[model samples]
Target: MAFVLTSILGNDEAIKILSYKWIWSEEFLNKIPLYLLDDLLRHYNRSTMEEHKLLEILAIIKKDFQKSSENERFRD
Candidate 1:
């Protein structure tokens, strides 16, 4: 968790880590907390350019988070 959390530090570090090569995957993305994930997305949305691959990865992660929250909502 701390390892993943480190990605959130500093301005645009999240975008750099996420947009660069091979630093992330679906399994790795799932390990990140939703709040931190949202924060990462904020940084990404603010700073990233035209990295299509990173956009796709982030979209999938966001969709999964939405699905999980929906499932939890129904369960409660």
Candidate 2:
């Protein structure tokens, strides 16, 4: 789902859609690239969702980022 959205809308726009619509599940969220997640977090203050939900999403994004970074380091 994230892949399709990213392909069709590009990362920035996809993130905007996801953030605004609150349409992302954990699996979908995990599918988004870490860079896009970072972009989302950077602009989170501009989103309309409740602060706690946004913080929860940020935690998931951070966890995914750490896991991806660890995997890359392990592969290297």
Candidate 3:
């Protein structure tokens, strides 16, 4: 997962995703590998790393969060 995350952080998809906001919370940011966030803007658009990048990332994360929430909800 770390490798995949590292690779994606610079990929087109990552760029596309980060090209809008920057709101990386300490919690979510913690889960990412230490190196993933350092040069994110190099791969992603500068717009994505704005302070609001955290918010934009939150938006994108919500989708995955929703999916996992459903699975967890059904687990028990």
Report the alpha-carbon TM-score of model 3 versus the true structure: 0.28
TM-score of 1: 0.29
TM agreement with the true structure for every prediction: 0.29, 0.32, 0.28
Candidate 1 local lDDT, 44-63, one digit each (tens): 55655345534555555456
**Candidate order by TM-score, highest to lowest?**
2, 1, 3
| Candidate 1 runs further than 4 Å off | 1-50, 70-76
- RMSD (Å) per prediction: 12.2, 11.7, 11.8
Give the alpha-carbon lDDT of every model: 0.46, 0.51, 0.44
Superposed Cα deviation of residue 1, candidate 1 (Å): 12
Inter-residue clash pairs, candidate 2 = none
lDDT of 2 by residue, 1-76 (tens): 3543465469986565445322435664566567556755565446543555445655554565444532232221
Q: Per-prediction count of colliding residue pairs? A: 0, 0, 8
Backbone clashes in model 1, listed as residue pairs: none
Please give the TM-score that candidate 2 achieves against the real structure: 0.32
- Of 1 and 2, which scores higher on lDDT? 2
Name the top lDDT candidate: 2
